[model samples]
Target: MAMFVHLTAAANTPRIRRAGIRADSRGQGGVRGVYCFPVLPSYTLTHQWLRELARFGPKGALSAVHVRLADAQEVLVGHYRDRAKDAQQWLTAAEAVARVAAQPDPRGWEVVVPRAIGAREVHRIRAVPQVAGWRYLPGAHGTRPCTCVGCRIRGEYGGRRLRERHPHPLDGPPPPVPVLLARIEAAGDPGDQAALLDALHWFGLRRRGPVDRLARLAAHPDPAVRRELVWAVQGWSTPGVAELLDPLAEDPHPDVREAVADVRELMDEQES
Candidate 1:
C-alpha cells in the first residue's frame, strides 16, 4: 500500500527548476542534484521558490537540499527540496546548520553567519538548541554522529541506544523549574509555550515538583496549550487538582474534553 502511494505521488509530482540547472521536461521528475547546506530562507522567499518549482513535476527536482547560508540561491534550493516531497530529506533547516557547525568551540559553542546570496541578508543564524556534546558534521554524502565526550557518554548512560543515537538530544541537565516557569509565563509564542509545558511535565514527573502554577494555565488562550496542560496534569493527585480539572470537562475544544474524560476514567479506575 505504501509502495503504491509512493509511486502515485512520484507520478503526480510536478517539476521545478534546479539551481545551476535547467528544467528537463522529458526527464523523470526525480531529483537530479541537491545543493545541501544548513540554513533556511524566509517564508516569503520559500513560497516564491515553491511556486516556481511546481511548474516542473516533483521527479525533476532534488529530493533533499540543505542551505547553509541564507543566500537567495541557497534558500531556493532548500525550499525546493522541502516542497518536492522527497522522502529522502531528513534534517530540518536548523538541524542541517547544527550538523555543519558541529566542531567543538572553545567559547562553549560556535555560531553560523546568516548571509543571504543577494539583497536580503540576515545578521546571524539563530542557534538550534542541541543535546550536549553531540556534534555532527555533514559528510560528502550525508550527516554522521559526533563522537565527542558528551555524545559518547550519552550513548552509554543516556536513554539513547546505539541504533537510536542519530537523533538524540544534547547532553546536560535540564533547566531549573523556576527558569522553565519564567519562560512559560513570558512566552508569547504558542510553540514555545507548548514545548515548555512538555518539558515541565517531564521535569515534574522526574523530580515530583510542584505543578500548581501549571494548573493555572488551563485558562491559556490557546486550545493547544490547554490540551497539553490536560496531559501535564495527569497523575497529579494533589489537593484541589480534581477541582481544577472539573471545568475542563466542558472545554470549548472537543479534544480537551476528551483528554479530561480520559483522565477522569483513569481516576475512577485508581479509586476502584
Candidate 2:
C-alpha cells in the first residue's frame, strides 16, 4: 500500500468525513482532480505541502486528509510546475512514491488524481499545524529576501522594507515617464524577460504612463510582454485606454486577446 496526504481547509473536515476529497480543478487545466503528496519515511517531507498550500488555501483552519492506495493504483506525478503545465506522465501508486522518495529536495513534487475519490478511499483525517512547510518558494529561507515587484504586493506587510533591504535587480519603482520609456526600450535583450516584466509592472502601478509609449509594447516579440501590456493598460485613468486596447483585442495570441477582453470589461465597469 502507498500512503498520500491532501491538505485542505479544516472547515471541510466534516464533509470530507462523508464524501472524501472530491476533485475540483483548483488551478490551470480542465482536469478535475485532487492534489496530494506521497507519505515518505521523512516526517517533514511527508507533509511538505502544508505551508505552501496554506499560502493559497482559503483562510482559517487547515488539515491533512490521509489517503491510502494500492501499490498498482495509477496516478500522475512530477515537478509542481510540470503538473501545472500538464507535462507529467501516469505512474503507478508505488512508482510515484518511489520517485518522490528518491528526490533530494522534493518540495515541489506533486501528485494529482484525475477524478473524484469516494469517501471510502480516505484512511483518516488528521489535524496538523496551520503553519508548516516552506513558503514563497521552496528553500526561500536560506536565500536573500526576494523583493521582486511581482513578489512584493503593495498591501502585503513589510513589503516596502523588504524591497529596501534586499532589492531585486529587476524590480523597483518606475522612473519618470521619459526615463522609464528609455529603460523599457533598452531592456530588449532576449534573455531579460524578468526585467521586461518588472518594467511592465511599473506601468500597471503608475497607471498614467503615456498610452502612446505603451502602445509600442504590442510589437514586442514575446506574447507574454504583449499580454502584460494589456494588463497594464487596464489601470489607465486616461480616456485613450480603449483606443490603445483595440489592437490588442485582435492580437494573434489567445492569452493576449484574453487580457484585452479583461481590460475592456474594466473599462465598461468604470463607465457604468
Candidate 3:
C-alpha cells in the first residue's frame, strides 16, 4: 500500500499573478482600460444641455431651463436648415456653444434660472459662491405646490393631490402650473421649445400620457421639433408607433436618423 504525499504549487504563483496584473496594467489591456468607457460625466452632459438652452434664452429664464441637449450634434445636423437668417445665426451660435460645452471638461461653469427672475436677477445670482455652476434655467421652479396654471395642471393631472399646502424645505411652493406652462410655451425660443418638451417628457407626459399634446408637434415644419418629437416618442410604445417613426428614420437630416436610432433602442428595450 503506497500513499503518495500531496504536492502543492509554488508559493510564487501569487507573485506571478501580481506580475501578470502589473504587466497588463502597463498595456491597453490593463485594469484601467478594462473599465475605460468614455468618461462623459454628468456635468459635461448638463453643460451641453445648458449651452443648447442658452440659444433659446432671448426669451424668459424658464425657456433657458428647458432645452434638452442629449444629442445636440444630432439635433443640429438634423434640423439646421437655412430657413431664416436669424434661425441660421441662432443655430450657428448654439452649435459653437455645444461644441465647447460637449468638450470633456466644461470648466465648472453654471447657468442658473430662477422662477420669474429677469436678466438682472440672473446676473446677480450668478455671482453667488457655491453657485459656480448655477444656471438660471427658464421656467418656474416646480418644487412646491402653487395655484399657477402649471401647478394646477400638475395637481389635477399629476395624480393625487396633497391634503394641505405643505412646502418642501429646499424647494418651497412651486409656481402656479399655468404660469409655468404659459411661460414655457410663450417663450418661442427654440431652446425653450426643446426645454419645454424636455420638461413635459420628464413630467411623465410623454406619449399617450398628459403630454400627448406634444405629439401633434411631430409634424412641425421645424426639424428641431421633429427631432424632439422622436425623443418624446421613445416613452410611448403602442401599436403602430413603429409606423409613425419609420418616416423619421428616413428623414434627410442625420440627426433625425440618429433620433430614429435612439427611439429604436427604446422600442428594442420594450420588446426585450
| Model 1 CA deviation exceeding 4 Å by range | 1-174, 188-204
Model 3: worst 10 consecutive residues (lDDT sum): 28-37
TM-score of 2: 0.67
Clash tally, candidates in order: 23, 0, 29
lDDT score for residue 110 of model 2: 85
Model 2 lDDT at residue 200: 75
In candidate 3, residue 92 scores what lDDT? 32
Candidate 3: regions farther than 4 A off: 1-207, 210-215, 238-240
lDDT of 1 by residue, 36-140 (tens): 233223322122222223222233322322222322222112222233344233443454444334533211111222221221121222222122112222121
Q: Against the true structure, whose TM-score is highest? A: 2
Give the per-residue lDDT of model 2 (tens digit) for 128-151: 876678878788887876676556
Query: What's the ranking of the predictions by TM-score, best on top?
Result: 2, 1, 3
lDDT of 3: 0.37
Judge candidate 3 at residue 245 and give its lDDT. Answer: 78
